[model samples]
Target: MNRARALWERVPAPVVDIVLVTVAAMDLWPMLWDDTRLGVALAALGCAALAFRRRFPLGVFLLTLPVALTQPFAIAPLVALFTLAARSRNRPLLAVCVALAAVTSSVPWPLASFSEVGRAMTLIDFVYSLATAVAPVLCGQLLQAHRDLARRLAEVEEAREHERMLHAQAVLARERAQLAREMHDVVSHQVSLIAVQAGAMQVATKDPNAKEAARTIRSLSVTTLDELRTMVTLLRASGGHATELTPQPTLADLHKLVESSGTQAQLSGELPPTVGTPAQRALYRTVQEALTNVRKHAPGATGCVELWQDGDHVGVTVTNSPPTRPSLALPGSQHGLVGLRERADILHGTLEAGPTTEGGYQVRLRIPLSTD
Candidate 1:
């Protein structure tokens, strides 16, 4: 069946029409001896009309109706009616074809034959002719409807699959961005501390203070390495469980971050005990980033960090005096401030960073404690 349909599809319309007309001409061979020359010529014209049925179905239909009226024995009109029904998408054209077939089938029978042969043969012939003409028209309508329905269903399925792909890509992009933010927050402060402690050890090499600084650097490096390994393991796991990653640091760790800044620093305000893990971590990282920027950009400057909690939000401010003498350069990219801003925005929070009025630079971060 598949091979036959492929072959039919490849055949041109003009060739198919010629073949159909030739078949119709052959079907009339048995009737030739019973009819006159004019009748045979008319029947031949009806068969020739079939060749144009697909191109101009209504025109072919009108032409075949007259031939069927003149010679009821010819089957060309019935074939032309079927072609008309199949090729034309217009409903009115289909109705016209069916009506012409029915009228042509009924008009040929005589009123006097109502009594002869008990009228059964005439009635049966009328019924058979009508059925034969209408059957192909009905089949063509059904085939066209089926093809239209299948095409619509295929379009709907393709649209749904495209939407699913887009949604999957969006989810993957969000997960990747969140992972990058986590790595930045976890690793940046530890690296800054290592750099600071190493610098102190280099400056005080002969003193006992240099030994303490070296030991602190060693301890921080080892802890940072352990945390990095744990993070890698969590990334490899199937589900992203927050507990599997590093524990979120809170206000308790702010003092260590400040100490690592290696400057005289003052801290104020009693941080709220009720802050949840997310808010606490965000606040901790904000202060850490601020102080790291201060240590690198404003060396040997006094700094102050303050924290305050209201009913449903916490505010943090880190300020440091301008450098007395600017150092050569910093060893890290200056994206800590931008990362802090993005973190605040992710939590639907706000951050402000600029030079303060007191000859210093200040970073202020505010985070909502409640879930969105």
Candidate 2:
């Protein structure tokens, strides 16, 4: 069936015109014995007009009008009428064309003689012409109506799909709100209590080592609580993108990020002077998550951070050597790497993370610079 439709579409317009002309010639051949050579001319002209029916529908219909008056057979003009109705439905124009067909095709018996029988025959001719013209016009109208209904149905389906997506987003927002509340109430409270206990320990301790350890614990606890608060606030934000008053970290802040991790890390290479915010954030998070993974899963490993611009893209790579000491910790949510992948997607960038040939874990990110 598909191949048949393909072949039909590939058939040339000139070939179609030639086929129509052949049919018209055959229709006119029977009438030649009546000495009306004009039948051949009218048939040829009518069929030839169909070649431009799609481009000039009304004009082609008008061109075929002569055939309706000169001959009893009018296959070409009927096809023209069908084409006009299928392409565009103008009630007044089609009505006029149908009326003209009925009137022009009516026999001229009244002109030949004023007998009652001749008038009756002319009426019969008019009725027959009207019936023939009406059939093709009705068929074309049916086709046009079917096309209109299909278009409307497709639009309604698209609207329904859009509504479904919006509802899903609303549900996601509500769930995120609930999660933010839980983190703020339970997790933040426990971390805050730890900070307070550490502070108390610093004040009560007498040994220098004990005092220093308590101070370090208090500082770490406070920092952790602050980070949790920031995360919860971001989660509570109402859109796909979280908007904060402060600017997000950039390439220049990479140094501070590595230093804060407390791992034996070194950064090498020059940074681009200007970078898109999305790319900068993606690379920063890529480096941040890579460092966190090393700390949690590959402890006491030396870390390397490299940032550079190559052609129209900026790239960052982070690598960590194998852990010197093994631990019994198992993987949790793996959300850090998941979040990094999402960030790279948002920037239309690429990220790769896995163990390297040298028995070390590595993460690499490459982001194209936006022309805009």
Candidate 3:
């Protein structure tokens, strides 16, 4: 069916016109022999006018009507009426074309000298002509409706494909951000501990403190590997087990985080025990990233990490002194500050980081506990 429709659509307008005109001439040929030769010639010419029916339907109808009156036996007028009804947009014109076809086709019947069989044959001819005239009009309407429906379906499918592409892009972006957060949390925590313990060992080489610092570094490295392994295993798990993968680290681990940084951080706030896990996790990450920056950028700089809760909100701040050596060049990760800002924004929090007037760097974060 689709192949037939495609072939029909591809037919040239001029070729369609030639085919229709040929058919109309053949249908009129037998009837023209019964009429006057001049009348027959004019009727054939009128039928030929139907070659332009699709482009000028009403004009064909008008031209064919006069020729049918001169030789009512001519069948070309009926074909022209059908063309007009099928292709013309004018309703009044289609009504006129249908009435003219029925009246002209019936006129020859009453004037004929006929026996019972002849009369029946004339009636049958009139009926067949009327049917042919109406059928093409109806078929043309149905074809047009089908074309409209197909166009709408194509549009809907295209829109669905575009929406799918956009959804896939959004999912990829979220996964990338999550992976970045995980890497920052793991690497920054471990590297900060290494730097702090190494600095302590450098100052305590002759004292008993060097052994404890060495042990701390070893433990820190081992713990970092275990956590990384757990993360990889969780990623490899499937389906339902994925949700039951690894537990997320939260603010409860903040104390251990500070101790591992090898910085003496004093806690001085009454934190709510019932804070949301995500909020707690974000807060912990904010402090972790800040302290990591300090250890990398300001060696031998003492610092304090503080967290406080007040009626549905949490605040965190980390501050550290300037580097001792003025010419010291700090190690840097360009993404650290950008990632911290993004994390705070996701949690609907605010973050500020900069050098302080007291020759130190400070990072402060504030997050609302409730979405309200």
Return the candidate ranking by lDDT, descending: 2, 1, 3
Q: How many backbone clashes does candidate 2 have?
A: 0
TM-score on alpha carbons, each prediction: 0.48, 0.69, 0.49
Candidate 2 — what's its lDDT? 0.80
- Please write out the lDDT profile of model 1 over residues 1-372, one tens digit for every residue: 879987988998888888888888888877677777776786777788888787877787777775565555667877777777766688776766776676666555334544664556656766776777778788778767877888999999999999998888678757755775666566755666775777667566877766755655655565566656666556544255543566657778887777755556888887667777777788888887777676667867888899987778888888899888786675887778888889889888899999988779998988886733
Give per-residue lDDT, candidate 2, residue 85: 86
State the lDDT of candidate 2 residue by residue for 38-122, as single tens digits.
6667667777888888899889988888777677676778888888888876898898988887877775522454365477787
lDDT of each: 0.74, 0.80, 0.70
Q: What ranges in model 2 sit over 4 Å off?
A: 1-63, 87-96, 109-117, 194-234, 240-246, 271-282, 293-372
Clashes of each: 0, 0, 0
